[model samples]
Target: MIEATNLAYRIEKDSMGERQIPETAYYGIQTLRATENFPISGIKPLPTYIDACVLIKKATAIANSELGCIPQEIANAIVQAADEVLAGALRDQFVVDIYQAGAGTSHHMNVNEVLANRALEIIGDSKGNYQKISPNDHVNYGQSTNDVIPTAIRIGGLLAIGKTLNPALASAIATLTTKADEFQDIIKSGRTHLQDAVPVRLGDTFGAWAQILSEHQQRIQTAATDLTKLGLGGSAAGTGMNTHPQYRQRVAEILAQLINQPLQPAPNMMAAMQSMAPFVNVSSAIRNLAQDCVKISHDLRLMDSGPKTGFKEIQLPPVQPGSSIMPGKYNPVMAEMTSMVCFQVMGYDSAIALAAQAGQLELNVMMPLIAYNLIHSIEILGNTLSALTRQCILGITANSDRCLAYAEGSLALVTALNPHIGYLNAANVAKESLATGKSLRQIVLEQQLMSEEQLAKVLDLEKMSTVNG
Candidate 1:
């Protein structure tokens, strides 16, 4: 029997025409089964997204150049076919089972086969004619499962940042920045352990939000940069055995150009091919970003808690009917969803760590699960940012009356008064205000702590919000 493993898994043009796989045929049915089988956390990675599309194309090209390892011509055929698919051709033929043992090797071949058949149609040849190109031989010459999966994932992560994550984060930060500038003078209560603690400007609160997101962006970007270290040069393991030495660099260069993303050879091909630590690092970065997101969302929801029943410092846009039966009721629905996304990202991170831990040498064959987890986390993060930007941040409007009201009554005002009157006296003023049903202003005035004019000037909101001032 001829071993086609080393050749690109291509179906060349034979006199006998080939058969086209139906969308509802074995492949599609298997995809369904595999998806169901990996229902570990109910996380279905968004394979239909642009990032996935670009990744498949780039990997296909890489596999084709490394064609001898699999099937060089098959790789070429897959590249040709996938290019068309990426260019808006042939949608149904790629229906394949996703739960193969060797990372996404089967899925990758399915793509090649589908594309090759589609390409044949483009050239007026019947489908399944194994004469010209096969999926394994031409398409996956020098590549192995160890190399292609990581490369696809890295590019996908980069694309997520460039196209999705950064845009949403920019909008969120922009909203907070604008609010910070606007509320620079608005003094309000700061809290520790959910208790009123000190005087703080509302603007300062927003400035902190902007800073957190900025820091998250930086951290995730760095982590994603680590992912750019490609395993393409590390065939099977790190030795590049059974592959041309130049094939590694050549494939990497070609893929980098094709994907329009800068990529470099992994410093240690062995490490890149052996374990899933890079994924763990990237997932950790995503989780960190998610944690920051949860913090912001929680704070915003608290600030907009209630007009009468709670401390209403800000107002959020009501996207849905918050209450099932209550009248005139609204909630921070977007914030709640954002919080959920953060939690999901955290879960994905844990999955990454666990999966990485299970890898034993020369390869981590848990490709299907690992890729799914990473891509799912990235997708949720992108969607969450979009939600926060459009449904929450942009929709948010200031509740000036509520803010001022809360500020007037808060014991936190005692902080500013303390600098002038001492902590004990300020505390007494706050305690007395609560007892007498009087505002902080009234207590201050009644206690003869300072003249009204002096209080007004010192209570200026803008001055409270400035960091340098």
Candidate 2:
């Protein structure tokens, strides 16, 4: 390490040449160039992504050491450095922009340099002293950005799903299921094509939403299984050149223990490294979930539309004043926020799809974009859903009276008379009830379409709304 005369900066050299780096920065030359190169987005690398990279370094260090590829002392230092990072130290050192170089070379090197410097410090050496611990030759031995980045993305996604998204989804599903049971007795008008169609149990609506989320969870989990297959040993290309013969298996076993996931090497390392399909698959699953969430949010807003002029069949907990000036206004802000987040997730999914297909011969240069969007989508969605469940779903209360009134008033109630009075007669009763502003019972009774005894059995709202009734 060559410190500047002022002691504030140090000189670090790469293949292109040397530059003055801040003395305190753990990152070295290539990372410094990336920071200077890409300022498109002010966003830095996400912490989960950082954790993924660090875990990879730790696993690789152990594997390389065990294989006698790197000195045991050096590998021990590297492992200690990675452990410090994993424990949340030196986080701000990972400074590469999310929109940096193709195939994430810049950000990969950022991780490498930070670990190398930290390992140097562990060995009581000065930072930027690559001779003792080179980022490429020691810290990132037998690894390449092409393989490492994709593996990092996979691990990052699994971590996010296990730690964040899955739990949120499970919570939301549980809340919906409980609400379904709680609201089962409340009957409300069901709408199709924005027109009153029939009566349904409000509980069933929540139950249906729960089922939708459950299915989405299964799809996401299935997609996540693909993430367990890693291409870490593939190195620069699928060839696995320079890697120890046992490096791939040992690293997979090591990483599995670290992540607590059933990780394995891909049967086709080339395909794993080259294809962004796993990321895309997970992204598409998230997109599917987002679409339904948007619909569910819209349903919430619709059900809670107004106290006077709209449905108002359900009341969402008023979190804050919905309007700037309206004294009692309480918009469906939670639901609205959910829709917005889901929309963003959908957009990220689209970007991931395009990027998944944009790869060339042996690797996808678009991995960085996919990495950011996929992991970010999972995390933000997890966060949003958790908030939605806590702030909205759990606090919701059914407007039982309003729901009953809507169910009784809906002209679709005449449909029960169809089997007894025939379709044409039921249609006539519905039309007359609408024109006269009278209840379907009154119109049917006035027309004597059925006896009072028959109407009593046919028009029971509970039985009509009940499944299989």
- For each candidate, what TM-score against the reference? 0.82, 0.98
lDDT of 1 by residue, 256-318 (tens): 776677787888898887778778888898898899889989998998988678767778887
Worst 10 residues of 2 by lDDT: 1-10
- The regions of model 1 sitting more than 4 angstroms off are 1-45, 48-77, 96-102, 122-124, 417-433, 436-465
lDDT of 2 by residue, 1-469 (tens): 2223455888999999999888888999998889888978878999999999999999999999999999999999999999999999999888888998999999999999999999999999999999999999999999999999999999999999999999999999999999999999999999999898789999999999999999999999999999999999999999999999999999999999999999999998999999998999999999999999999999999999987889999999999998888888889999999999999999999999999999999989999999999999999999999999999999999999999988888888888999999999999888888888988888788888889999999999888898883
Give residue 241's error in model 1 in angstroms.
2.7
Residue-pair clashes per candidate: 57, 0
lDDT of 1 at 215: 88
Give RMSD (Å) of candidate 2 vs. truth.
2.1
Taken over the whole model, the C-alpha lDDT of each candidate is: 0.68, 0.94
